[model samples]
Target: MKWMEFSVHTAQEAVEPISNILHESGASGVVIEDSNDLVREWNGAEDEIFELSQEDYPDDGVLVKAYFPLNSFLKETVEEVKQSINDLLQHNIDVGRNEVTLTEVHEEDWAQAWKKYYKPVKVSNFITIAPSWENYQAAADDELVIELDPGMAFGTGTHPSTVLCLQLLEKLIKGGEYVIDVGTGSGILAIAAAKLGAKKVEALDVDETAVESARSNSSYNHTEAAVTVRQNNLLENTKMKADVIAANILADIILRMVDEAYERLNTNGCFITSGIIASKKDEVKKALLQSGFAIVEEQMIDDWVALVAQKK
Candidate 1:
């Protein structure tokens, strides 16, 4: 199906509010460009990395996205959203929030057309992701594994959240320990843990696409992680305890699920939650504390936050 593409460029700061308006009005996807105004096409990577879309970025934080349904009330929504954009433009704001770009996608497959862009990506010292369309080679001398392919849910390891998770996974995961990955998009975190030598891994996602994608990727890793991919909200399918729990989910979800995370922990085990907004860190911390966890450390990259907590 064809789509109407909208490229709304404004001071990066206004991107988020504009995106909220567009999404509320019904946008399938929104791309928020970086400070450098780069909405990257990591060459075949796809997935919603966080609750925040490109519309949430600032300073050249442009929204370039399209939604299928050419004959919908897209024009009315665009015009209505433009009023908000213009109000921002009328104000003296940061550099990225001053301009707006809008356009329509006259033709192209709005569905399943992103597959051609998926390719192999190297994330860490011994890890690489190869989609089903690509091939991966591991040197015998090198400790390498983390084979994955594109899926509908998220986490091909190219996204900021996934990248952050992989970075932390590289630092935290050691050999022969139980690991649990909540919101296991494409099984990226689970696959990373398995590659890092987790004795057993439990990967779960509410989305069926994510479950299937993760299972397919695990097969490619050849390391054979005992992964249980399920369609529950969080930790609903697993009664098995864990030494580590990784959650790359939205702030609200993290706060709501902190108790479950603490309940499933194996004393002193780490709970790593990313995909939090810098603004919501305090609330998440409070939730963690209420759930009997102490903040071990907190890290931020751009607007995203990664909190490392330990069970008491």
Candidate 2:
């Protein structure tokens, strides 16, 4: 089979949103090449350390790449992706150069290109994300490993927004609590909640591919019994109540569902939100507050911010 590599040259702030745009366009996988990775500090895990060539990255900005099966609709999909990314600017997101290019590649080459960049890394004190192909052992007795084949979706759980969500889940989940993961790409957070002893977890995604990927990842982690993946658009008209509701999506989407999130959560329940750029941090916080949530904690990594808010 043939694949079309859709690559974008943009600022670091645009990577997450553009990657999401590509994934929602039905791309089989996404790859991010950020120049900052060269000098970026890792958490110092032995397995996380690897040689990164300076040549594979852009000189000034980040390159976001995604693979789509070569088909007649490929051109149309690319246009839609470009438009969706351009829409990010309305939200005040910096898209940088926003240069896009497409290249043809064999299935084998595209598959091999992205795999070498993924490896096992602990995202939180208790949870670690390992690629499905890697044989990673827990360094501690309390470690919880989430094995994911991220080719199906845009999440590897290594992005700072995701890492922040994982860390908050580790600290908040006290076992046997019901959790709802909105926009559950790759089902990473739902899987982590289950591994952390959530009695039941419902992982929701609007994209069928993401729902399938989340299900696959949950099964791989043996959390399928506790984690359920379904196609839903951000808690719309859902009667399910959860002890905790987690969303690691763009801040705009987060705001759209804030009221529903608060309503669907049980009394004194927690709402964990990530994928918020620092510039939009105050806007999101104000919305959560107006929705009757008291901001309890905030965590930041680089230009991204995550907040933990609670119902009174």
Candidate 3:
């Protein structure tokens, strides 16, 4: 089969949202090429061994590429993707050049292109995320390895937003706590919670594809019995009150669901939210506070922020 390779030149800040756009548009996977990865200093020779080819990357800014199956609607899909990305400008998001290009490639070529971008990444003290194809061993006895195929889902479990969520989960989740992971892309957080000893975890996502991916991932991690993946909107008529509720989603969505999150938690329950840009930190915090949640901890990585709130 043939594939249409869609490439966009966007700013670092726009990568997450743009990649999300592609995924929603039916792209099978995304490949991020950031020039910073080439020039940034690394602590050891591990990164140096990758041997990046300068010709494949832009001189500045970041390149995000994704693959869509060549179909009758390919042209229309591309146009829709471009329009959605252009819409980002209205949100005050810097889209950089925002130049989009398309090329035809065979399935084999598209498959090989994404592999170079994915590797084993240690996102937190206890969690190491690796692609299903990589051969990675835990460096420590306490390390938890999550193997993900990623596919078209939004969460890789290694993004700063996700890493922050995982780290907070590691610190906050004691044995037998009940967890509800909203927007549970790839089911990483729910799986992590289960692996960290959560007695029961419900992983919820509005997207059926994401819900399916999360279920498969949970099964792969041997947490299927502990983590349940379901299709549900954010805290909509949630029947179960959990000890912890995690939502790694946009700040606006988080704001909209803050009250519901509070209502769905048991007394003194923890609400963890990430996928917030630093610019919107104060706005999210205010909403959480107004919803009667006390901000207990805040974490920032790069330009993203995560907040841990407790119901009093």
Candidate 4:
């Protein structure tokens, strides 16, 4: 099979929104190549090391890449993608150069190449995300491991936004509480919640591919019995109440769903949100407050910020 590689040159601030745009355009998986990774410090478990090369990254800005199966409508899809990326500027996002290029390649060329870069990443004190291909052992008796393929999904559960969300989950989950992971992506958070002793987890995503990937990851992690993957759009038409709701998605989307999340959360239940760039943090915080949530905690890693809010 052949795939079209869509690559974008953009600023760090634009990475999240641009990546979201690519995912919404039917990309199987997204790859981010930020130049900062070359010099960034590795704070993983003591034994973990990332061997990165200067040649593999952009010199000035971040490169966001995604793959789409070659199809007749690809040309149109590419055009739409470009337009959507440009539209990010309307949200006050810095898109940098916003240059886009497409290359055709065989599936075999990239299907396994990216795996070498993904290893067991200790995203939080209690949780580590390991690729299904790697044999990762828990370093401590209390450490929880989430095995994921990510396949063509959005993330491997190691992104900063995801890490922040997972950390908040670890701090908030007290076992046997119902949790809902909106825009679950690869189902990392839902699985984490289950592993952390959530009695039940509802992993929701609007994309069928994401829904399937989440289900597969949950089953692989042996959390299927407690984690239910569903194709739903940000709590729309859902009636189940949750003790906690986690959403690691674009801040704009998070704003759109704030009311829904607030409504679905039980008394004193927390709403954990990430995928917010620093510039948009205040906007999200205000929305959460207006929705009757009292901001309880906030954490920032690099340019991403995650917030934990409790229902008043």
Counted clashes in each candidate structure:
24, 0, 0, 1
Runs off by more than 4 Å, candidate 2: none
Across 1-312, the per-residue lDDT of candidate 4 in tens digits comes to 999999999998888888778888888778888887777665565676557788888998899999999999999999999999888888799999988889998898888866766888777777888889898888889989999898855667767788899999999999899999999888999999999999999999988988989898899999999999999988997888999999998888999999989899999999999999999999999999999999999999878899999998
Query: Model 4 Cα displacement at 66 (Å)?
Result: 1.5
After superposing candidate 3, which stretches have Cα over 4 Å from the reference?
Answer: 36-57
The alpha-carbon deviation from the true structure for residue 26 of candidate 2, after best TM-score superposition, in angstroms, is 3.1
Predictions in order: lDDT: 0.65, 0.88, 0.86, 0.88
Error of 3 at 113 (Å): 2.2
Which pairs clash inside model 2? none
Model 4 pairs whose backbones collide: 28-152
Candidate 1 lDDT over 30-106, as tens digits, reads 54445432444232224311222444444444443435256667677778766765664453333353445555553
Across 1-312, the per-residue lDDT of candidate 2 in tens digits comes to 999899899987898888877876888888888887777666646655677788888997889988899989988998899999999888788999999999999988977877777878767777878898888888889988888897635666788888899999999999989999999988999999999999999999998888988988899899999998999989986777899999999888998999999999999999999999899899999999999999999999878899999999
Query: Cα deviation in Å at residue 50, candidate 4?
Result: 2.6
Better of 2 and 3 by lDDT: 2
For candidate 3, the C-alpha RMSD (Å) to the true structure equals 2.4
Instruction: State TM-scores per candidate.
Output: 0.69, 0.94, 0.92, 0.94
Scanning candidate 2 in windows of ten residues, the lowest lDDT window is: 40-49
